[model samples]
Target: MDTLLSIFDVKLAIENLPFVLSGLPMTIAVAFLSMGVGALLGLFLALGRGSSYRLLRWPTRIYISFMRGTPILVFLYVLYLGLPEVGIELTAFQAAVIGFGLNSAAYIAEINRASLNSIDTGQWEAATTLGIPYWRTLGGIILPQAARIAIPPLTNVFLDLTKATSLAAVITVPEMFQKAQIVSGRSFDSLTMYITVALIYWPLCIVISAFQERLEKRFSRYVNE
Candidate 1:
């Protein structure tokens, strides 16, 4: 009982709470920065894949294929280590953001493509019959509707990216997991520190999930119609 109690170390966890939390800002920066950049890239990729031009479609396909096939860690390592060898240096934070952004963009592209395709073909025809410009029709009619469908899935991907930010620890970005590792290493209370990290992540994930649920409910009427 005493050994288990010592391992848990509630007092130490409480004492180091702020230290562990200090990395929250960096973690959030990485997650949201990736999501923001990824959304834009993903939108372009989706459009490229859907385009009639072989020049656009083929290149986008290859890019998505390569990104999806490669592991994010490998991408991170390539950016952080391989690039430096070629004189393209990147800070750990920059490397993490780029890696996460590229990875997230591939998944986001697929999700956006699926959502865009789920929109009816007749809508495009109707807009054409009305003599609407293609870009205007897409912007005013198609994308808004697709966005409603895409939000839930995109939010899920955002959450996944947030969790994956833990991988940044490998490059020493000093994110939440890395902070926990440092605290654990110093205190020799790995169980307690690790559990504290879980506790922090759990609440954050729950809050994001709740926001997604609310967004889904708000769009339910449009989907039902």
Candidate 2:
């Protein structure tokens, strides 16, 4: 008990809780902003991947493959550190968002592609026979069904992005883990600070997971109706 208490330092954790939590907003901001960018770009990539034109399909395929193959940390470093050498400057926050966003887009594009492809071919034929435009059919009929299929995997991506925001600390984005590091340095209690941050991340992930369950249930109900 004494050894554990010395290692954990509950009092220190409690005292630093608010300071660590002060970075929550930045963590959430990076996550959602990156998700927004990923979703939008990913959708276009999905569409291009399925396009008949070689120009579109091949390029999107290459982009997705390249992004997925690389580690996100290296990409973040490239954007935050390397870009300035090329005369393109970006702030730490901007670099984190763009790096995570672009990296996630590859994964999201694959998910979107699979979901879109799962829809029945007959639906497309039926819509075409009805003289509905491709865009309208996609927007009205296909995407809604595909979205339901996508929710689970997309939620997983979001969960990952949320946790992955901690990596932004490397770029000095001042997120939760970064704050924890500061506290650890000041107090000389790295184990306690890290454990505290992990506890904070635990509840945050739990909330996201619970929200995902609710979203899945709601979508299931819609589908049933």
**Per-candidate RMSD vs. true structure?**
1.8, 1.1
Q: Write the per-residue lDDT of candidate 1 for residues 40-141, one digit (tens) a residue.
A: 999999999888999999999999999999999989999999998999999999999999998889889999999999999999999999999999998888
**Candidate 2 lDDT, tens digit per residue, 25-124?**
9999999999999999999999999999999999999999999999999999999999999999999999999999999999999999999999999999
Q: Which candidate gets the maximum lDDT versus the true structure?
A: 2
Q: Which portions of model 2 show Cα errors greater than 4 Å?
A: none
Candidate number with greatest TM-score: 2
Q: Which regions of candidate 1 fall more than 4 Å away from where they truly are?
A: 1-7
- Candidate 2: residue 201 lDDT (0-100): 88
Model 1, residue 203: what's the lDDT? 92
Model 2 vs truth, CA RMSD: 1.1
